[model samples]
Target chain A: MNPKFYRSHVLICTGTGCVSSGSNNIKSRLTAKLEESGLQDEVKVVETGCHGFCEKGPIVIVYPEGVFYCQVEADDINEIVEEHLLKGRVVERLLYTELGTEKKIPAYSEIDFYKKQHRIVLANCGRINPESIKEYIAVGGYEACGKALTEMTPEEVIAEVKKSGLRGRGGAGFPTGLKWEFTRQTPGDKKYVICNADEGDPGAFMDRSLLEGDPHRIIEGMIIAAYAIGADEGYIYVRAEYPLAIRRLEIALEQAREYGFLGENIFGSGFNFDLKIKKGAGAFVCGEETALMASIEGKRGMPRPKPPFPSVSGLWGKPTNINNVETFGNVPDIIRNGADAYRAIGTEKSTGTKVFALTGKINNTGLVEVPMGMTLREIIYDIGGGVSNGGKLKAVQIGGPSGGCIPADLLDLPIDYESLQEAGAMMGSGGMVVMDETTCMVDVARFFLQFTQSESCGKCTPCREGTKRMLEILDRICSGEGREGDLELLEELGDHIVSTSLCQLGGSAPNPVLSTLKYFREEYEAHIKDKRCPANVCAGMSAAYVIDPETCIGCTACTRVCPTGAISGERKQPHVINSQLCISCGACAEKCPVGAIAQG
Target chain B: MKSLEELRKLRAELEKELAARNSEGKPKIIIGMGTCGIAAGAREILQAVLQELEKRNLDVITTQTGCIGMCEQEPLLDVELPGKERITYGKVTPKDVERIIVEHVVNGNVVEDLAIARLEEGGI
Candidate 1:
């Protein structure tokens, strides 16, 4: 008998998802309470990494009796402590209620969200202490590099990747093995492996989280790729915007070098590989492969034409293998586990899981990696926990500015590279922003176009001139000056820009305009024909707020908080908004004591 | 510098620990102390659980886990009983420690209203 020493374990989620939601405070409070109650010595509290089911956070598990709690709040703490801790009674109200059932689940594994997920790349993400190198090593972190260095030849390594059917996750679904083979076969003495960490796509943080949660895994993956391609040096081109990820990566690299996993004849293998970090100056265009390489060379980040693709002649006029943070992160797993094992997860063509930074109007707005064939419905509904604020799902923007908007009708479509492209959207760097019915499609199109227009290098006439013209037209339309031929003019200019642009940045710049036109033509018609923004998102088309006489509670909260001196009324009387002076900032609506304010 | 074989051995050892506890009738409790949980007072609940078990000298093991969704609920706790069902308690407080110990552990009867949900077979 193990002395009958108190038999329960409390597992707390220390993943980024929970951290953002204030899990740290909960941990500290629980610790203080346990110590005060003299219950600290028996049960041990361990802070683990991310659990894939990020929708329900600040999750706590009581062992021996698997009790699962969802949406745990601080105010409800004492009840939990008194009812469950002291009395050894499970707290039923705090239990996670299944969608259709009264059955309260007590274990993490029983949740439907967790059951479907086969976590591979993200296996250790939520399970270990991210800051501790020993914990990473304890989970076979650098073993894949060891296996590749000691056992597999360069060709064999490439062959395994080729067999796995892993594709580039940085927007374009280029085959990873094919890209490596190209660099390997290229006759260049100074081959380089570059990790594209300049994740500038709006609302995308998959790369950042992966680096923050498990930086060593990416390093291990890169080392394997460097060995496979016979590259002597590697560079991680990350944006300066991600200070945390950059710091973590630097630490991880130092740890790897110290452990003999990086730099000079790694793992006793004859192959020597070293990694360097290059900071990007936050240019959106720098996400392009050529621009990323140029930035590393201490030049202004700008895209160059293809045909001298990075694999053949890139980075100081030498052969280079450029894989994004996600692509490299998958390499170690492919080698550690067999390629056949990976190939079994995703669709036949697009094998393995793809990581997405699920954002916008989704309930579970965090990092998610699912098999390639998982439908948008599963991602948005089951994993993302449906549209946020109980709003109707309108559209999903995939692949950032370079990708297109996918309407809700195509929510059931499998989320493979080809399927997304077929639905007029691309898997551009795994940024999936779920938009709701309140979003204005016309406004959405304008926003992305403005981004690309500003980010364009202006090296090409088509993209520079064409994008500017389209943006001007969009601005006019958004400002309620749109004419009947404006939509046609946008399509014509978009086609011209896409056809004649120098590189992918410029080439795919018109995707947002083209896609929004393809799906939400009515919105465009309303903007041009009816001159009204249906979603009330376009500020130019929206009217100022006015208080209804019946609902006004005579509270001066709205009048007091209004930034503009637009509302005028005596106390205890309904206020009338002067439209000329009104800014339509919605401060009055928010400050309204009674629900009297309405905006058109 | 540890070799690949050494790293593999370490991994195997860690995995062994994770798998070893389930062999016994002792129940395992996993506390969600993810970033969200920690922010929501998970640390307090964690300490409370430990102190309670230590005071009673009960044979329960406590481990830390990650987020299980439901961001609205923080400081979540999962309790597994031997030969019986698993229950999750949400919004746990240090003050609730005494009640949990008395009603759940010694009595073998669960506090149903506060229990988040019950676990199915083979569900950890």
Candidate 2:
């Protein structure tokens, strides 16, 4: 039988980032416009997953020609269809221009943001229609599950993963094959595999993107994991906040079941396995294995001490194996291409590519996957297109709230499990948030402390009370109410919290504060002793804006722009800002015509 | 649904459907969709090209182009093959699409009666 074909394939990204930026509207308009042109039969509009260049979202790629149009709006669809699709003339206006240059990148592969990325897990993300099972199959999606089930033994599969040096991408960097082996070694009839999709990091969306973009890859990975661990049932603990991810996963599960990939006798190998998605109530701590398993079992999501790890007792007291979304997303590729192929990409200890959610003060804010040994400078400067607004970079906060801040001097540090840990930051689910020079270090520490403090399950003392104490000190320092030796006191308390914390949360909760203190100690000292914020970020610690009488020119620009009646002077005289009425809002300073305003 | 062979068979069928996007080296059929081409019923020519390709199970990449500045030739179709010169057929109708695919594309023989011009190589 002949298959349907189109002259051109218009791949419009419908991932959450593009969807929020109105890619769906753009897609519908393109489809309607194609029909109007009477070329609907020849032209096909395909909705795929996240292209990862989320900074320039609503991305449209015309295949066969491979013309990449970014930041496309619904209104631009007509021009794209009429000019490019209909006429074959490339749309020059919609092309993505290179950063700091007028050169337009007509092809998607030529974009700097994608040029450095090694997308093993995300290979099918922006390429295929995620909702269609046929598309997934055509891309050799479930072939790994079949290979693992039919060709390789469960022990062989575990050994392959172990040989590949695959680690848990859920921040801990524990060996994934070891965890699977532990579960398989444990004596249990009913074993389970869980994919931890409950990603709650502030700037982390790598897991969510994997789930939304190519969910079947994750499903295929989980099936292989279940077969390895001798499990027939599994659950994916995804947070409720990810509505789009959840919806796509639901569709993938239904489709997989229909194709006999999820139900009994998958691939006719008699390896009966299935999956269920357990929606978390959006607790950050549930990302922990114990807390995740607890939440899945209909209990309050709180972390329990290790030793009786999930491998021995988890999810209604069964030996279970769990991995992160990206970890599972990488499994199928590893199985299909063998352990040696996977081991060849990354560093010795941390093999395969790691997906990072690149965000915050960066020019290209998107999801990027690079090999393990790539330097921070490469990911941030080369791929991220440097800091946004041309601002000088101050630091990069990795591993979310539980991670530490790496100062600008350490930008060349090679990113691997041991290297990041040695630098006081874990590979915490790959949330790399770039901080510019304008960001106050003390405030950043305070912000992370506030997040961990509020999200604390309150079951432990060090996390609940200790985080609060550290937060108070940070708040005092930011608000210009800090006392002498406050920095030393924070260090002492931070050490105590690290020692006394029950779970990983409390143990690593002081990472941001401690690391910032270790690196940017002078910033903390200036905030405390000088009663000033170097970045002018803290409201109470902002330096007073004083008008320089010599340069003020008496233009009354400062007076008119000031919200408060602070600036007062005659039409021809230099303006005098009443210090008492000044809110330190910098309006008068900005409005100074002769460049007279200065922060006193 | 049950066997590995069945899975492979299904995958093979689906891969053909997505071949236009994945295949690299193949014969291409470029239809002029410029304003002039559309007015000259190029839309019908495009539909006919797709139908002829599907009818013969031909693995050809069909794409559209904008105004080639040949308004008098209303509908223009360009066939490009690897290591071959690009043949431009002007004033093409829906009926000529099949013969062009069969005689020129399949048999490797240009229909001189309809062929108007030729470019050496890498002509869009």
Candidate 3:
């Protein structure tokens, strides 16, 4: 062996967030510096996957001494090389300053943001060479599959998963082990396992990141599932929007097949399994398991009623087991590490860590995985680095269209199946969109309702007509034309739609509307009673601009920027905005230089 | 192309080599080369480090890794000098490479100002 060569390893984030921030230039500059200094021989640099802390990227870490450097720029390279690399001194200014304390911490793991996170499904995500099959193998990649094939029987493998209490990471928190068992016990000559990668929620990218960062892990998980369920073929129903994820999945499939872990696999044990990629056309409705299966079958994606859930009969009328990218991603770990180890991490009901695409007003806007029982406040403030812009927290929207908005008052609620359900929200595919005080609650409800309304397949009248009518009421209320009973109508219609719709797409469509009504009813009442939007978010209810004479120089800057000629004033005088002609596009507010514009 | 058994044997050999190195006090240096890291120019820095080590015939091993979430600082370096301390150098450039080797690796003295942080008694 080459005598212990380099003393330290440096990991730089190359995930999507860092790539957009010019991480590549920093890599080249670092290489050039290292070579010139002749430390290239003693030092090593490796670019790894996303390390989850996206708020302060592009991130850099040095380990076995884990020193985290945040928001470093290209010009800072010389100081790092000259002072730290050569003189062994840390640049304190470049260190990540914790929110409450001014003290500079060195190690990456000790940072409060990562201390609470339990990374299981994301174990190898930011740590390994994702593209290198050799590196994956070196880290005991296929060992789980080998063990499953060589040692354990299919029944025993299934039993272990059942004991682990693993649930589907896909929006609906169904039991993964039970789903597999149902497909296994069902009467069918040919069975299949489908991994859903068509993650369509607005703020969700957990599935995409998993596929890109650790494609092999998902593949291995699928293979294990296939072996357990007697599945001969598998399909990864990925969305066409994720080109990077698709490329990685294809590469991973090829590598798995080459290793004999897939495609007539055997560790001297007879079991056959193969996986294929099926791209979705980016329809939000296709995220539904039934519609997703239909899309895979070369049919116009649409949902079919239950009783014969995917486990009983699905995907070309076979006993098919459907699991999302995250669910499949967990299989290998569960198998290799044992069920008890996996179960020991999370709450009694919801076992293991959950991957969340924490976006919107949160400081850390990338993917994060915390244990099941972690409170929303912990996720937002502790793991997510708190709200961005130091804005006051208002509400959080969990579970996308199928879920509801949780108010700030309930921020301390622990995130689990039962707790979130009781709080009028479901952990829908782990999409946590944090909102600040500036966000209008009524507008938030309307936005999600609009999303579901447009994406509805229009198959049943309750969903098709109910969503349309609900959206119209929301629009009227937001536009200040709401009647005295508009709120009652919304609540009544929302319940009707939720109870009468055909599939989950229709059934859960009214969550956003109902949840907002339940929590922010006053905002709705204000639109009708006071003819105003409390947060000044509604386009129709809010006026364009009110000039503050104290600050306005009468430069007519607002008039010039306004698309409409609503502002009238001479040069160097305070302008008067004509509300009759103002469109409330906020152009005048944006163009105001002296901080004279106000909108309400 | 090799048979499955042959591939397995080769994998075993590589594992053995890795295990032996890990057991010894020879600190292993991993370079982030994920898509984010590569896009950030980690490839070039990785090559430079390997070439420099080859020229000096140092008893160090180099490997590529994935992103570590700090994309702003690409081509990052982690130095685990034997018996001393492990330091993370960020925003590294090619011009500063030679000085790192001469000052840190050869002299048994670590460059202070450039380091992002030092791994102390407990892991970071």
Measured by lDDT, the strongest candidate is 2
The segments of candidate 3 whose C-alpha lies over 4 angstroms from its true place after superposition are A1-8, A28-44, A73-93, A543-563, A567-577, A582-600, B1-124
lDDT of 2 by residue, A107-216 (tens): 87899999999999999989999899999999887888888898899999999999999999998999999999999999989999999998988989988888898989
lDDT, residue A159, model 3: 97
For residues A222-281, write the lDDT of model 3, one tens digit per residue: 888988999999999999988878887788788877777777645657788888999999
Worst 10 residues of 2 chain A by lDDT: A585-594
Rank ordering of all candidates by DockQ, starting from the highest: 2, 1, 3
TM-score of chain A of each: 0.86, 0.98, 0.92
What does the lDDT come to for candidate 2? Answer: 0.89
TM-score of 2: 0.96
lDDT of each: 0.80, 0.89, 0.79
What's the lDDT for residue A543 in model 1? 73
Model 2, residue A160: what's the lDDT? 94
The model with the greater TM-score, 1 or 3, is 3
Candidate 2 interface RMSD after superposing interface residues:
1.8
Interface RMS for model 1 = 9.3
| Over 4 Å off, model 2 | A553-565, A568-573, B39-41, B67-74, B90-93, B109-118
